[model samples]
Target: MNLSFTTKRLNVIEIDASSSMVEHHQLTIALPTILTPAVVANLPGYFQGIDSIAAAEKWLANMLNECRLLMLQSQQQEVVGLLFIYTEKHDAHIGYLLAEEYWGQGLAFELLQGFINLVGASSQWHKLIAGVDESNTPSIKLLKKLAFDERASKENGMLFFQLDLRKYPLEEGTI
Candidate 1:
C-alpha cells in the first residue's frame, strides 16, 4: 500500500528496509536531533544507550523490522521527526517525536491530524491508540484536542488514549 503523505508544510514518507540509502543516512543524522534528551525522557525504553552511529543504526534496523516507521520531512527537505505505528488486530498504536527546535510550533498537531485524515477512513484499523507519560501535559493536551479519549491509566504513570475512527472520522479541511 502507498504509505507516503504530505501536510501543508511537511512531507511524510514511509521508511522501510526498501527506503533509499540517502534517506536512511539522513534519518541517522536526524535521530540525534529528533530524539533529544528532553524528548526521550518522556518515552521510556526508546533510544536507550544510543550514543553512537553504530548503535543508532542497529536500533533503527530493529525498529524498521517491527514497526511501520514514517519519516517527517520539512518543506525545506529536512528530516525533522518520526512517527511509529504498530498494529494489533484492527487497532493501531502510534508514537511520535519531533526535533526539539520544532516543538513550540503546531507541527505535532498538524502531523497527527494529517495522519488521522490519511487513515481514519481506511478499513484496516478501527481505533488509534497512544500511550503518553502522565507528566507529558503537552502531548496529553494535543491528543485531547484531536478528540482522543482517555481509556486507562497504568501504574507506571502512563496514560492510555484511544480514538474510535468510526465515531470521529477526520477528513481533510474538516479539522
Candidate 2:
C-alpha cells in the first residue's frame, strides 16, 4: 500500500524502495535507542542482532521487501517509529517501535489509531494480531485501550492479542 496519513501530531507514510535510503538512515539512529534488546525482547528474532548502520539498513531492506512498513514521522519530519504489518493467511500481524523519547505522550496511541483507520478502509484484512511481551505493561495497556482482546499466551513470555476488524467500528473516536 502506497499510502500516507496525517494525524494531529504525526505523518505516516508507507515507505517504498525509492525512499529506502532515508528510512535506512532513520533506522540506524532509531535501532540503538528504540530497538534495543530490552524493548524488543517480546518481538520476533528478526529484530535482534542489529548493532550497526549496515545491519540496520539490511534489516530495514528485508522488512521493506517482506512487509508493509510505514514510517511514523513527527511534525518536524523526524522518523520517530515504524508500524509493521505482515500477513499470514487471513490474519494481519501488527508490530511497531517508537523512539524512547517519544513514549508516554499518547503518540503511539494516535499512531495506532491511524493504522486502524487505514486498515479499516482496506478489504484485504479482517483481523489484527499482536504478540506483546508479557513484561511490557505499556504495550499491553495500549493494546487493551485499543480494544484488542487477549487471546493466548506463547513461549518467550509473549502474549497474543487479537482485534476482529469485522467487529470494529469505523467511526471516529470510537476507540
Using TM-score, give the best candidate's number.
1
At residue 12, candidate 2 shows an lDDT of 92
The prediction achieving the highest lDDT against the true structure is: 1
After best superposition, candidate 2 residue 56: deviation in angstroms? 1.2
Write the residue-wise lDDT of candidate 1 on 1-175 in tens digits.
6578999999999999789999999888777666778778867675656667777788899999898999999999999899999999999999998888998799999999889888887658899999998998899999998989999567588998998988656555556
TM-score of each: 0.93, 0.86
* Error in Å for residue 28 of model 2: 4.5
Worst 10 residues of 1 by lDDT: 166-175
TM-score, prediction 2: 0.86
- Tell me the number of clashing residue pairs for each predicted model: 0, 0
The Cα local distance difference test for each model comes to 0.86, 0.81
Clashing pairs in 2: none
The sequence of per-residue lDDT tens digits that candidate 2 reaches over residues 1-175 is 5657889999998887677666657756766556767656656789887777777878877888898888888999887888888888878998888877787899989988877877776747789998887888998999999989998568678889998888656566669
The runs of at least 3 residues in candidate 2 whose Cα sits more than 4 Å from the true structure, single-residue gaps closed, are 18-30, 171-173
